[model samples]
Target: MSEHAPVEPGQVLPATELVRDRIARRWEGLNERVQAKVQSISGLDRTPEVRLIQQASSAGTVTKRVSWLRKAADHVHAGAAHLAACRKGCAHCCHIAVTISRAEAQVIARETGAKLNPKAGVFSMADSEDFGEAFKQATSGAVGKPCTFLTEGSCSIYAHRPLECRLLLNLDDDDLLCQLVEGSATNVPYLDARQHHVASVAILGQHQDYDDIRNWFPQGRANDTPSTQHKAD
Candidate 1:
């Protein structure tokens, strides 16, 4: 049969149905072992510190220099490579209070058409009452709680996950991020502390405030409710 045959007049397909079909087809191409790996890591437990790392926004300006970012990009890319190999069901990163730059947020919203919950007020890195104070109290920047996006052991907006989300992999121990910075993994270079600090500051300034991205998210999703899974069958 021709791949691009015209459809019958007046026959309509629901967009959601089409999306599900596409999801299924994509998964079908993967080998069984690879597919199984994705599933295995999909719902791993979150460490309490992960949330802090997400919130620890940098408090400075970004130079936007390509060379500096280029150096950091390799580490991120290596980290992402490890992450992509993970199972579909593994969403431990989703459990953290993820923050994004204005650019990242815009891309995600545009791509996924997912709207942030209006109930949760905008989150800001400058808000002394929230992030600043939290920073003072906690050794790590995480919120010590699962992020609101997590539901039913999954991320509600998986397709539009931010850069940080795409970088996480199973650590096997609670202090993974810390270890990455301090460990001896040959392939994985330590992420430059200065670069991350500058990047965080740049993101916060671009948004004019941290709350800008928070304004996009919704609130009051059941804490333990897992997000609905979408994959080809």
Candidate 2:
């Protein structure tokens, strides 16, 4: 028997419940499709981690899966190296709003021993009115600030950077479009990031949120704090 039955012409419909159920079903369907696409990609046969993503159900497992997917996307981006204008020492695009999965953030924190500030006013796209609004809200205080991992105009965590950073490949001839202080460029090229993005989001669900890359590190490093000195002679 169906949980919901046909309603009469003048009957009060369970509109809110129906809408919520419909949205949930749609999300599940989309997640299934995204997983299928990731599984079908060539050269993933050699990647054991890709296979493990199917069995992932926990937060830690999902993070590992996302990390593997980011690496695979990096490989694909490298294959199209000729179409990209991005190079070392060109860090203009690093100033933009970059959304990342909770899993990715946790991985970065673990790797770098950085503390995460949950009250940094980061907003999730899932809760925003739209992508543009989400970007605006999440990056409110982070626009001109360089990424925390950027050192001397290069990414210090290049090997383990987030998926968003790995997939961004500027197609513009120069950095003019990326040099803009507000809004992203339209001509930037990127690998097909849909699979990884959707898969990670589906796995992370509401737990995922955006945070500025700069906020991940502790305010003061272990060496930055003043050490106690013995009484002077």
Candidate 3:
């Protein structure tokens, strides 16, 4: 596919199905092992002071840069080289507030033929000490739910998933602590990829406001493509 070509549902949907199947298989393979280990850990810090790092957006056409960011992040995840409790079906992390740039959402919409959820309003969020918690307070209704792209415990747009999703890796031994439920509030350590997140802000190489993924893509894939071509192209 050309870098500028609109992403076809056919191109992505079949792979999405395969991804779901793999996740299910992996989940089934480890369900008993993970469950057995859940009771042993207690330090799942729910209120980790998450830092929202920001930098001036950088330059690139949508495809090359997004691909670069993902590949780099994948390399980081691989080099981190620890077996994580995170598997495809274990999507507790997906339920949290995920932020993304408009460029990314447009790219995703165009690629997946997913309709863009028009923003109700536009506003800027400065880098905050507690970005997630701050977002939770400002938009009382925005988060604490599964990402729209998630389906049946697997990510429908896994390959085209945003940087926020890609970099948020849990470096724990099991899924027990990452569960966003009672008693698991203890901090679960994740791969230190804060620099990548800063790059995520800078990937587009232009100043753009970042917003929640669901705001830009509320639910469901569609035949309708994003009309604006990301407004970047």
Model 2 misses residue 194 by how many Å? 3.3
lDDT of 2 by residue, 1-233 (tens): 22333322112223365544543453455444534444455444434444534444342565566655665555555544444545545665566556665667777767655566666535675775665676665666554566655555556566567767776765433333344323323223343557656665676665556666655552412322222110000
Instruction: Flag the better candidate by lDDT, 1 or 3.
Output: 3
Order candidates by TM-score, high to low. 3, 2, 1
lDDT for each residue of candidate 1 in 77-119, tens digit (9 for 90 to 100):
3433443423444343343345555545544555555565433
lDDT of each: 0.39, 0.52, 0.53
Give the per-residue Cα lDDT of candidate 3 at 127.
Answer: 52
Worst lDDT window (10 residues) for model 3? 47-56
Which is the leading candidate under TM-score? 3
Give per-candidate clash totals: 30, 0, 11
Question: Residues 116-194, candidate 3, lDDT per residue (tens digit)?
Answer: 8776213344555555664555344333466677665567777677776666655545554344432223245565567
Candidate 2 Cα misplacement greater than 4 A, ranges: 1-60, 128-134, 181-192, 218-233
What TM-score, to 2 decimals, does candidate 1 have? 0.39
The C-alpha TM-scores of every prediction are 0.39, 0.60, 0.61
